[model samples]
Target: MLIVEDLLLLLLDDETGTPAKAGTLPYALGGAVLVELAMLGRIDVEGAGSVLSGPKVVAVGDGPLPDPLLQEAYDEVTRKPRTVQTLLLAIGGDLWKTVTDRLVERGELRRESKRVLGLFRTTQLPSAGTGHEARLRAAIRGALVDGTEPDTRTAAIIALLSGSGALPELRPQLAWSGEVYRRAKELEKGHWGASAVGTAVARTTAAIAAAGAAASAAVITTVTT
Candidate 1:
């Protein structure tokens, strides 16, 4: 029998705080994948859970393995990546829609596709270094494996993607500013008019305004051009 708690701990250790750990998204997604794998029979649930609970282990030689095992392993391998990607979409800050739409355009995901659809059929994982899409994918994956929180991990991933020109620069800034707002609220309870407090509020407001202006400009540009 699979020890649910042990599995959770192992996965959590690998994904905690990173994009994969963000909200309930990872658990929901990973659970679905686990179910598919279990049905396929590629993995013995108990054994698989044991392996995942510790250091990474090669599953022996194979082109893919049996459908059942393959399916289960596939989901397991991709859990962190998917979680990170969703986290990015969820808190993309100013560029939430833009980033996600672009990713869809590049075949990382299909905006109209259902989650139950097979990943191979519904989405094409981009080749590493192919473009901004690849970079974004890498960023999300990195964040998840590093055990960063979803929001914070997403922010860092956005920063990396933006730096690489995969994303527009303004979006990451906005996301970071939103974080500042949350932090500021906490600070306001104790520190009044402190430099950090003042800075946080100012940055948050500026980011919001910039996002709004950018959005408006985009609308105008789209209409005019």
Candidate 2:
């Protein structure tokens, strides 16, 4: 499964089977795609310090990314020079639906379309595969609540969620909002705990991704408020 797919699974509400924060989902997914590309060496990020400033992302390959959503993002990056936040906003708006459709095709999510009061149409995705989401939530909880070492994928999700202000939505169930917030700070500081993730991943990249997510969240907050 794609990293964004896993991220989206956690962003989803178990009880309602919809995203907890609709505005933040796209930005989170956009960050996920960039992280995935970085992990694969398909893209390169350059900056002067641990935190990205005047950072530039360039594609490493000549062809399209295997996933169309990712391909579109790649195209956008190549089309111009943009900071991580700019790229996230430029490509983020559509990632939620793109990833959702990809999930529907994978049979992990079942699509539901209906008319609201028989007037306007709406679409929803109910969990078709429960086991995956269960594992995802458990891993996140383990990282935040139980102090278990999280893998790179899990760490990325937690960082993105926390940065985007979406992690608190789970406080009603997990009751670990304080821990979650604390762990997010650690992740932002380039601590991935005692895991392979720490050795394999760079702190600067995590900071950049988190910054992008936080910037996107700020934009959303501004628009709504």
Candidate 3:
């Protein structure tokens, strides 16, 4: 929803103390926008929350460094200049594999073969870099705005409709159904704060709908006359 997006943008701007560019805006604002839309019944809040809080692990090589070798290497490197071959032989095959795997994943180290010797022989190091946060933000924004995919566009529309209070009321007949009640309870718990703000939004939506219905009835009556 535009309102939710605007609010998120405002929050990010406040936090950063400046208007964020498109590149930076997505990372800072995407989570808030997704959360707000979920609160408004436009998106799956649970799924979004899970993605934001998923487990992450940082690997150093193919596996953990052997404790004895690691300690010795640390001391030796700090005290004397050792050759790469010397360090590899001292660290051993298993630890080196782990280290190589980790390096490849992070784009820091490359691998030519699955073999430990191959890992040691290949020696191209990637440059240190940062900017993934900006890319993530851009991707989220693109998914919302670009109508290329039907599912994404539909999600965007649902978010817009729900945030704008345009969704049809949960029918009384269906309200107490198991799924309905469960979802409602979940939403109530998750969106307690938003619900307080939503009272004003609901009232405004109701007033506008009522006014439109009345105007339509008047027009119909005049046409009949």
Q: RMSD in angstroms, all models?
A: 20.1, 3.1, 25.2
User: Which candidate achieves the best TM-score against the true structure?
Assistant: 2
What's the distance in Å from true for residue 210, model 1? 44
30-97 in candidate 1: lDDT tens per residue?
Answer: 33223223233322211111211211212222346443423344544434422222222222322323
Q: How many collisions per candidate? A: 8, 0, 10
Tell me the TM-score of each prediction against the true structure. Answer: 0.19, 0.82, 0.19
Best-fitting candidate, scored by lDDT: 2
lDDT of 2 by residue, 21-119 (tens): 776666677778877776666666666322423266666767667877677777887886667766666777678777888787887788888789989
lDDT (0 to 1) per candidate: 0.29, 0.70, 0.29
Backbone clash tally for model 2?
0
Candidate 2 wrong stretches, greater than 4 Å = 48-54, 61-66, 115-121, 197-200
- The better-scoring model by TM-score among 2 and 3 is 2
lDDT of 3 by residue, 1-225 (tens): 232232222222222222222222222222223323323433221111112122111112233333433433344333433322222223232333343344346543333323455555433333222343233334333333342222222223223222222222211111134543333232222222332344432332222222222333444467679
Candidate 2 lowest-lDDT run of ten: 45-54
